[model samples]
Target: MHGHGYGQPVKQPPHTAWLVFLRVLFVALGILTIGFLTWAMMLRLAAVTRRSLDWGLFVAVLAADILSITLVAIEPGDEIHTTGGYVGILLLLCTLVGTIAYYLAADIRHFLLQQQAYEAQRTAPAYGYPAPAAPYGATTVPTIPTVPTAPGAPGMPSASGPHTPPPMPHARVPQPPQPPLTTPPPQRPAPARIDQVRAELDELSDYLRKQDGPEGGR
Candidate 1:
């Protein structure tokens, strides 16, 4: 049957000057990121930071743009240019995937936090210490009191019904007794090495005096 195929060209979105400007800005950002990454790889710049990550995104987009430009340049005069075109498409697809992944991760984190908040709210006690009781003006529900059983009442178990033995008082764990303090054995005085030094000094002084007297007398 001669019919228009289902694979028809989709209508392109209308492009405004602002949209064009934004595209240019994005391309610029991409270029900047790529430049920074190159600088970092060359050791001309420091390690990555938030700014680096931002720039990397910009670079990725710029790479896509370069690929696109290359494809267009190669496909002059409607001639098929498969290589550059495919490369450009691949770069763009990579960028899109990265962006989507980032957003999905952020959304998942938000969802988890929200779920945690919901769980916290659901589990809060009706009346408790940690959470303050409902405000003064809030409607409060009255609790019913349990009735005490009378002794010897029909069908009522005796007070002696399986007495829960009081939990044995926590035994005072005796810490190991500290070692008894004994007077440290008196240390022997370090041998008098200085005595030999004193004797040598005395001998030298006597020798000096004898030499000085004999020379003076002469």
Candidate 2:
């Protein structure tokens, strides 16, 4: 070996190290993409909006990283085999779709709840009773009467003389008769079978004994 050009040293290309660096870089990028997407999906499902642009920014950054990784891998002398990168991109896409679907479902549920509340309110009874009828020859309908207490009632201010109770207010139009409350039919109790219950208890006891035996016990 010394006879041929005094044993020259072999020069290794820097491109080999660069290739290794590219591989590590792509792998890290892919892992980061997957982790970020998972976190984003969890936030979206939980309906957390404090970050405001979290969804948009997550998508943008993921897409940019994917594109950059793809371009780097495609470049000459940068032979980085990263199937993980493709998998990561797929996972990110799935997460984005899931987040959107979750939001839509939540929105629909909220809208339905609001609509039901509105309908309940619309069907609810008014706060007070209807106004009383007008007096004879009065142009306007009479206002609802305020009750004056009887003279002899406790805590009541005495009137000048013995007081007569005010006449009950009547509606101008007759109301439809209310339907009577119907009692629900009573359910008959199931007939008991002493023999059947005894048989079941016997079977359960046999199962328990078998389970407690040393050979078969857990």
Candidate 3:
């Protein structure tokens, strides 16, 4: 990070959001890694810093990513000879390996730098004068007041090891009584049956016999 100033550079605060953003960028980079590498090889090859291993690793990662992209784009069998295809595939594999190597190297470098900074802070001693001891062995120890403990106080346990918990009261919850089950009466037919018709005919025949007997008496 750079600031618009002629004075001392200010240390930027670390943002977790930036790390999340970088992760998203890295995913996007994966898709265009090889393309970026090839572009760098063509135009920005000289831009790669030769001063430090970290810079070299950075360049290598870029190159590998670009090469991987290029290799992926090349379709071996389509319009190209078998030999060319095989060569392209081999180059692609090598580029992919380089991509992985560079990525790991960059991560390791960053982690080491962070760890070094942490260690530096840890090892750095504090600069200040120490407090003088109580006037050459003339000790002055502060007295702590004694507090009386109750029989069953929170901090102090009882004389009988520990206090037992009081027994829980028994509660009988009333449940609703179940209703008795009764079978339903069968449904009768709407129309008369053959047995009902036979009973009616027998009653009619008895009535006709009674009428005949009354007529004979007359």
Q: Rank the candidates by TM-score, best first.
A: 3, 1, 2
Writing each residue's lDDT as its tens digit, candidate 3 over 118-155 gives: 55545653234233456786979799985566777777
Clashes of each: 4, 0, 6
Candidate 1 is scored at a TM of 0.26
| lDDT tens per residue, model 1, 1-218 | 77443433223332346444643454454446532222222121112122455456546545655565566467646764577656655555555555444433443443455556555656663233245658888997899985567766887655556436588887798899899999999986566867877889999999999999989999
Error of 1 at 68 (Å): 3.6
Lowest lDDT sum, 10 consecutive residues, model 2, at: 5-14
lDDT of 2 by residue, 30-64 (tens): 35654343334334424433344655645554565
Index of the highest-TM-score prediction:
3
Between which residue pairs do clashes occur in model 3? Answer: 33-65, 33-66, 34-65, 34-66, 34-69, 37-66
Full-model lDDT, candidate 2? 0.53
Candidate 1 lDDT (Cα, 0 to 1): 0.52
